[model samples]
Target: MICVGIDLAAEPAATAVARLDADGTTLRLRDLHLGADDDAIVAAAAGADGVGIDCAFGWPAAFVEFVSAHAAGRMPETAPTGKDGRRPLAYRRTDVEVQRRTGRWPLSVSTDRLGLTAMRCAVLLDRFARAGEHVDRAGSGRFVEVYPAASLRIWGLLEPRYKVDPDARAATLDRVLAAAAPIGTTASQRELMVRSADAFDALIAALATIAHRRGRTHPVPGHLGEIAAAEGWIALPDGGLAEVLRG
Candidate 1:
């Protein structure tokens, strides 16, 4: 099976892509791309059996409601007040579910600037969907949302620190490669992962794609699956139950 992973930054300069070959036991990094734009990302991902993109796929339910109300002139344009009295629209139910399952909170796409990346992802997903790509958000479909940081934590590997520190980053790369021992990597790929944190994340996302394809990752709970399909969900290795409600 062939899988593609994208560590999509809001700016094209920081984005990276990785291609993987999964042959039952070993998952190989077949190719890597850096500083990718939308066209480049789409081209690189073409022909892959599955794709893992590192970005939220949709808006929070409340945020969508807020936007609709504001657009229809029912509410003020300036950040419509959430129903619960707080800006509940700032975060999605799926984001909270991912946090409960992984013990790591993802940034709010509605309130945080990660929303920029989500906007980009939304366009890309739409393009793919129009091209006849079918994605069942709650299941291991043709496309899935990935969180490399959460995947690293779930795998008992290094988490957030690896990106900024050179030594930690190199060590984490080594650890990931060592785990996929049978798969060979080029010297250039190693250098790229060491020098570009985005590339390394793309690698992790590719690994997560393999996990998803192999049924090693968990699905959104039945109760929450519908919301996930509508609001977006993060894919992670199989763990505990994830509910839609956030406390």
Candidate 2:
């Protein structure tokens, strides 16, 4: 199986994509692209069994509803006045569940700068749909939302300051390599991961895609199914890297 991972940025210059080929036992890093544009990302994902994107697929459902109601000049009767009361508008159900399981909150796509990247993701999803690959934001189709940091935490490969510190990134890469013994990477590829946090995250996103494909990630709770489908769910790995790569 082939899995493609994208570390999407608000613009093409900072985006990164990684492709992995898994043969049921060993997985090889077939390609890695830095400074990827939308077309390049679409090409990288073409024909892949699963495409994992490290970006929110959609904003919080409540946020969307609120914005729509305000635009239509029909505001709700009650308004949330405080952060606590407005929490539902800022964070999705999946985001809340991820925090519950991992004790760390993923960025709020509804309120944070990450929303810009998610806008780009929205365009990409539309492009895929036009191309006949309709992606399910709830993660039932070829494309799925993935959080690299959350997956790293679940797999026990997370390193402190890895995103900003080179030494920490190198250490994190070493730990990931040790955990995923079946993963094959060239020396230059390893160096790329050490030098660029985006590249490192793209690789982890690919691994997380494998875990999702193999049913190793936590599923959306039955109660939150409708909300998750509308708000987009984050696929968090439930097992270690070794188990994820075993496929």
Candidate 3:
């Protein structure tokens, strides 16, 4: 099976993509692209059996309502997250659920600068939808949402500090690639990951795609599936990522 993974960023220069080849057992990194744009992303995923993108697909249900109310020039009686005053509508139940499961807090797509990235992804998802690609909801669609950082922690791999620490970046990249041993890599791909954290994250997202496609993913609580379908859900390995790591 062929899966495409995209590490989308607010700026196209920071974006990256990876293609994974999984024969149902062993996985291989077939290609990697850096500094991609919307067209580039679509071209890369043209024939993919599955696609995993690292970005928010939808807004919080409350944020949706809040936006509508704000547009109507009326005060929203309830806070975005259904609470009282001052809580931002940034965290979705899936985000909260991920924190409950892994203790790593994902960035707020609504409040944080991630909104730009999500906006881009929203356009891309629409393009995919127009092209007849279905988002794999809970490992059932052709596309799915992915979170590489959380996926790394769930896989028992070293979660690295790539943005701030130059010294830590190389080591962190090494650990991530090492943990993804199931994906047969070459000398060049290793060098690429060593040079670009974006590439590394894209690779991790690709691995998550393979994991999800294989039906080895964890789903959100049943009650939240509806909201998650609209807001997007991060795909984590069901039990452990050992199966994907094994040679």
Q: How does model 3 score by TM-score?
A: 0.89
Model 1, 143-198: lDDT tens digits are 98888888877776774579887678899887776656666689999888888889
Off by over 4 Å in 1: 76-87, 239-247
Tens digits of per-residue lDDT for model 3, 70-189: 899996554444344324367777787788879877888887779989888888888877888775444468788888888878877754576555556667766665655556888888
CA lDDT of each prediction against the hidden true structure: 0.79, 0.90, 0.78
lDDT of 2: 0.90
Q: Arrange candidates by TM-score, descending.
A: 2, 3, 1
Clashing residue pairs, candidate 2?
Answer: none
Candidate 2, residue 29: how far the Cα is off, in Å? 0.3
Q: Candidate 2 residues 1-247, lDDT tens each?
A: 9999999999987899999998886889999878999999989998899999999988888898899999999997896669898998989999998999899888899888898899999999999999898779999999999999999898888999999998999999999988887688999998899999999999999989988998888898888888888889999998788876776
TM-score of each: 0.88, 0.97, 0.89
Alpha carbon deviation, residue 95, candidate 1 (Å): 1.2
Ranking of predictions according to lDDT: 2, 1, 3
- lDDT for model 1 comes to 0.79
